[model samples]
Target chain A: MKPVTEAELHTYIDGALSEGARAEVEAWLVAHPEDAERLRAYAEQNALLRSLYNPVLDEPVPAALLAVRSHAWRRYFAAAAIFALGIGLGWLVRGMFITPQMLPASLPRLAATAHAVYSPEVRHPVEVTANEEEHLVGWLSKRLGTTLKAPKLAPLGYELVGGRLLSGPQGPVAQFMYQDARGQRLTLYVSRQRGEPRDTAFRFSQEDRVSVFYWVDGNFGYALSGEIKREQLLNVAGVVYKQLNP
Target chain B: MDRRLIIEHIPRLRRYARALVGDRYVADDLVQDTLERAWNKFYLWRPGSDLRAWLFTIMHNVFVNQARRRRYEIEQAMEEVPAVSVRATQSEQLELQDVDRVLRSLSPEQREVVLLVAVEQLTYEEVSGALDIPIGTVMSRLSRARERMRQLLGGQTVMPLKVVK
Candidate 1:
């Protein structure tokens, strides 16, 4: 064995070296008596440092030092919830502003106003007679640039009382009225815009208790307005959507 | 590792913290800080893993970083004072205080390695993780620190002078 380096001496004291290294260092040190004494002194110092600090672990931890549950977790969860809500709201607003899918909400208000204005008719109800239904249909078709067919109201026990030319938010509207024997009335408002594509389902939106069933098909939009039961409105809307879309 | 389980280990953490930092108040504060960090980032911990080691790692890092910052701040503040040269004073008794003085005399890195290995009794693997050092580095650091501690203690005691005619 060769002379032990200072590193090997330290490793020997700390018991970190392999057995081969230990044996080599040990044999080398046995030949060097003075280095052996120094090694013994180094070992004692290591032991003494250990003994001095080891008692700290046994000492009672002060009550103040313990890790207790904190209230900050609530704040963290609240912050996460707020972040999610903000993202959701931003998406909803963006969808509403940028797409026609959200146009239903605004339709009910317009429908309610249109119904209030036209339902009080006494004498002049329709612009043309049902006897001149063909001429009236042809005129409206030319003016609206789309086919205008009145919806059948057979299921509701009402005849086509009359229909008149009216104006609504989108453009010129065709208001078709229906009446039962009890004289309860309902109105269907129709309009057209080349850019607003046809929607194919009966979508009811309500404002001030008036239900508006509005739909689009190809280049025309139809809105039926009435103060009616939800089921009755849906039934009328069903007929309107089926006739236009079909 | 949820904090409720980690919080349950607070007694042991406090004990370890006290052992690491000599001052009881500083130890307690370190433990509290460690707990606060763990609780705030509790979701960051995976469900099944070593919670105790994870917590100790946090605690050890917080202590080291804080110690380094405090040292730097003190050094900056003390720069204006008249620099007094420190000379070792002979003490009458060989008490734990003497051992503490010897330990403090070692380089901070050496003291950390020595304490983690000897006092805390953490394995080389745990010490590596806690200190953010490689396992091999931990082994070498512990070996060197042990040697340095031995030399400091040897110098403190009065004995027959070695290699002096």
Candidate 2:
């Protein structure tokens, strides 16, 4: 029998060898304890590598990083260029402002996109249903690292459909979806702010047909998005703000 | 080009980057660079070919360039800071910290090769394509990397494949 090379030993551990080759290597390993021991060490090292870094896959990809796929986000290229030039992208985007020119780069866009994508889902709009309100709230609050309340929209003819944890620019965000008798849906998107925790008046940002009434209160940024009239959304937003604050 | 396909690969790319670069921020920066490059020249990607491998190849280029520049900066700063990992006297069982410390001690080339195979579970051909190294180089580097790690972390209790979690 031809000698199984060290490469074959590594390949056998990796499960990359063909069936015949693998069988050949297995036979070789049975005859050779030293090489088998070496293979086990290598396999253990791989396990360690996976254990150390696989958690990253579960982490929310930074909102800035997610925005790179948008062609409208040409500005991100400049940030990437700066990063490539040795400037931390984090620092370059530290003072991010939502100007009309940088509108696509705003948190409101993220909120609006989240609303558009989710509000239309019929059967599976939320990860946690409103039936398990406490569980939903607790799960999202833990993820967003803030005490979250699914505001009472029933008074305004909309019932809490449910809520979900979303990936935001800074970290995990909470989105609470509400539906009225007419089946019109609205989403309140809550994301944490990294800047100084100061309260700001509600700011309106319209993307396509998604009208978002957003505000910054303390460390959290809230955006209420719906396809309804601005006045109606504002009224709901007012009620939401009041219920949330109260 | 549908950018959505690129988005699907982001998690795995981030995983590889996290392993390739120890710092989460730096790892994400590499991922962002890869995303940006893939988005810009998305037309270059052959449709039938492996999108994950293509994205990974782009990540490899971004990582290598950033590492070259970072190595220069570290060299300039005279910051031999990686030595800070507390060495365990007894390798009774290789803890996460000990594993990380040993991995950092590896040469960057070996680290990437081994990680592509072990962590990402890429095939030898896939690893070669992703890292832009030949098949022979991948095996040689994997062999050398595992041998070095064996020497550094001798007698570690074999743990289950953590990927199961």
Candidate 3:
């Protein structure tokens, strides 16, 4: 019979050993009374730990935590309403403004273009990867003169790949990239804008293969672009908006 | 992935966080943060992967980050003050209170491993994934943690205390 290693014993206590290995450990334990006694002690310790903390699972989730989902949906509806109003207003003033100055591409279009250019890159997708999230947030916050937090997107099935600093027409732009399990990537482009805080509305636009959901909050304009459906992108955008606003 | 499916893990997340932080309010805050983060990046989660393990991983990262920030705060408040150590002696019989104290007495790394394995019932591999540690490291830590727990609880007999007539 092979000797039972300490690591194997640990795995046995953890209930992680294979069935055959477990049978071997059980047979070995039956022969070694002292080892069996020690295993019993380990089992008792696990029981104690569970008895001490498992009641927490029965407790009602606090209101604050429950509020996250409700708050997100509320923001989603608000953004949708504002978006509808913006579309209506855009059509009303479609041909009214023809100024001599050529209007630069809208931020959403610029963001989608940027997303198309970078999201497909296999290497060098971001300047600073998500592994250095603290540095990424700090650098971008400093460069943009606003506190920027990279939204946690793990629940939405995207992990931050990295972020980059890009030059915009107005100032520096921060682009955060996230990749899903299937290797699909999304980019969040944030830029500083100087104007009366005119819009807090969320707007959607598509450029080629990428779709963008953009919104202006305070001094920052955020554009989330990906090759994803509008409804799905809207849900992600709603989360980003709530986090940024909160 | 459906948000509802992620929401189903909240109770377990809270349980793990409560054990991890040893504070109810702080645990709830960690859960809230974890949920918000998870909801935002829900796409990154693989369709058939263990959602619970993924949530625990996020909670672990949040807990670590918060601990790092709090350590900074403590340092700033009292510079160069050595932390006081509270050790459990074997003389104390392993009552429930003693178990609580001993669990809290563990170093954070050991405490997390023990809690994830014993309380949360996560497999060693799941713990390794959640903690971003090697499986060997997880096994070694679990071994040490279980030994410490045994020494702490070994002497106690669970027989009821006798009452004088």
Q: For each of the candidates, give the backbone clash count.
A: 4, 0, 16
Q: Is candidate 2 or candidate 3 better by lDDT?
A: 2
Question: DockQ for model 1?
Answer: 0.12
User: lDDT tens string, model 3, A1-246?
Assistant: 678998887778777889888888877786776666677777767777788778876675554564354335444545555576686664444334322111224888889988988888888899898889999999999999888899988999999999999988888999999999999998999998765453344555678888887766666788999998765776788777767765
Best by TM-score: 2
lDDT of 1 by residue, A1-246 (tens): 577777677667666789888888777776786776677766655565567655654554443433243436545434555577686775564444434242345555666677777676678667775667677777766667677787778676867776777665566777778777777777877776445463333455666767676655556666788787654665666666656545
Clashing pairs in 1: A198-A216, A198-A217, A198-A218, A199-A216
- Those runs of model 2 whose alpha carbons end farther than 4 Å from true positions after fitting are A69-246, B72-94, B157-165
Q: Per-residue lDDT of B1-165 in model 2, one digit per residue for the tens?
A: 244456657778989887777777878888888888887778888877999989988988887788787783245224433543345444534477777766777777888898889998999999998888899999899888888777766545455322210
Task: Quote the true-contact fraction of every model.
Answer: 0.28, 0.59, 0.50
Off by over 4 Å in 1: A2-11, A15-22, A33-35, A70-72, A80-246, B1-12, B43-52, B72-93, B135-144, B155-165
Question: Per-residue lDDT tens digits of candidate 2, residues A11-110?
Answer: 7888777988877887777777677777777887777788888887777556566456434345564566566655665455534542223322377898
Better of 2 and 3 by DockQ: 2
TM-score per model over all chains = 0.46, 0.58, 0.52
- Residues B1-165, candidate 3: write the lDDT tens digits: 145456556778888887776668777888998888887667789977998999988888887888787763234325432233224344434455567666765667888898998988888888999999999989888888777766755434443222112
Better of 1 and 2 by lDDT: 2
Q: Which candidate has the highest DockQ of all?
A: 2
What is the TM-score of model 3 when looking only at chain B?
Answer: 0.78
